[model samples]
Target: MDKLHAQRAPGRPKQNEQNIPLQEIILRQAAFLFMENGYEPVTLQQIAKICKVTKASIYYYFENKAELFTASVVFMIQLAHQSTLRYLEEKDDLRTRLEQIAKAKMMHAHVDMETMLREANPHLSEEQFGRIRKAEIDIHISLAKHFQFAMDQGSLRSGDAMFLAHAFSALVMLGSRKHVIEHNTPQEDLPQTVVDLFWDGIATQPQHRK
Candidate 1:
């Protein structure tokens, strides 16, 4: 990664006073900037400035802008997957757990992942894209396992767990969208509203017979 191109400057120390690796700092900053602005508009210099490091520091870890972009995105996805697992495990009841997960997701403004990936597609190579896809699939599989467990406990209807997981995630994403909420809709109520809608669909119910 260090061999691609060296700009006209004396190299800076790759570690800060706190002993944090320059590569980790660069990835965190780059992830935020790329998610906020998309791949095309974000520049290595911009990330360097935000990270309080020289552009050469970033080049030390990443060969080029495309490589940096890919690494940062994958890092962000892995962090998100870790966070979702923590949230999922916080509550025992499925409804409460889903609400907690939704609220955690809604706590921040989010760029749509699909839209972001589409914007980044032209710059990323196949292997870089594959890494990101695998990270995304990991999160979905984690959620699907929880859904399958709820089904086994008879809390949810017997259906495709993976599909239910995807459906719940989609509903949360839709609820989290800025335009979906009205001025009067309290932010605190949104998670419950989303979970209620989802629960009303696949939750197990008493069978009715004439």
Candidate 2:
């Protein structure tokens, strides 16, 4: 982050120094701005103005708008990953853990996926884009192991648990992405629904025999 002193009149008080530095402050604010206005629409000048700093100061830290945008996006991605990891580590049972992982993925999907897709541009390095896909695959691998163990126990139907895991993942991605596209509902609602649907399957329980 480009460090800059408070531009406010000297009367503004030295106590302001206790807050995070201006460059870091701008990075935090930049993430929100990018999410709201998209990375392309938001200019460095605009970010500097919003953060109450000068353009030169922004340059000191980011060098250019693209670098700033990349850093902000990377920060957001890390936060999403940390949140998912935290939720996923909570459960001991394989099935239960898978459910938690699915739920966490859905909850942040709106903020993470939508923003990334909206801001994506051809000029941006695909190398950076590769990180997003790899992180997703890593998450899928972790959850797939649970399915494998469950299959070995015979608690779940036998077959290739790995295939079943992948199939379930595909189904969830479809539902989750569509839910984002169609309803635009909050992320929490649809992922939870998808998880429930997955564990139980969509078929309704048959009525009790007379």
Candidate 3:
């Protein structure tokens, strides 16, 4: 049978492979608008105007606001996964591994999340919010497994997985604070200090527990 004559999968559109470029362009612009302005305030008509397409064209890809928001979140997660996986695979030592994880997470969070969250907060329904919360939790849980692996490899001290996961994530999210002239700390020095504290200690090495 001819490929075109073959039945399409149920509920799935016969998407053109090359058209993905256009889809991504539209989604990227839409995601940015949503992140900056928010889903509740932005309509498909607005997105179309920004993307320079008619409302009819926007409807060809996404059905509604909810679907578009969900797709944007999924896209962000996918990009994060790709970046983390690539960096994590390259590091050799456990300390290096942890450092890479922290740096990668921090870089991504700083560059990406604030706007994403600002928009997502009001636009999402209760169920959507809960689901997103769980998805983020699961991402942390998966990261925790890597920390546990480091411990098993005798790189990090043995400890609670969930606690460590939450701790590491929080540290990255909170970042580090330091004074400039008063403290003489350079801007570049702060993140390295964060990495050191996770492995070393706030106090001297002699006083710290393994």
The candidate that achieves the highest TM-score relative to the unseen native structure? 1
Q: Tell me the tens digit of each residue's lDDT in model 2 across 5-46.
A: 343223322113657766567777787788656656778888
The backbone clash count of each candidate, in order, is 0, 0, 0
Give the candidates in order of lDDT, highest first: 1, 2, 3
CA-only RMSD, every prediction: 3.7, 7.1, 6.5
Against the hidden reference, what TM-scores do the models get?
0.84, 0.61, 0.68
Whole-model lDDT, model 2: 0.64
- Model 3: per-residue Cα lDDT at residue 127: 71
Model 2, C-alpha of 194: deviation from truth (Å): 2.1
Model 2 bad stretches (over 4 Å): 1-23, 92-119, 131-189, 205-210
Off by over 4 Å in 3: 1-21, 36-43, 105-119, 176-187, 206-210
Residue-by-residue lDDT tens digits, candidate 1, 75-181: 98898788889988876687888888888777754566678789888888999889998987888999999999888999888999989888888888888775234
Query: How well is each residue in 91-208 modelled by candidate 3, as lDDT tens digits?
Result: 5765676677666655433223444566666766777666556656766777677878888988778999789877766666556222212234344555666768766767774573
Q: Identify the runs in model 1 with alpha carbons over 4 angstroms from their true place.
A: 1-12, 179-186, 202-210
In candidate 1, position 4 carries an lDDT of: 43
Model 2 Cα shift for residue 120 (angstroms): 2.4
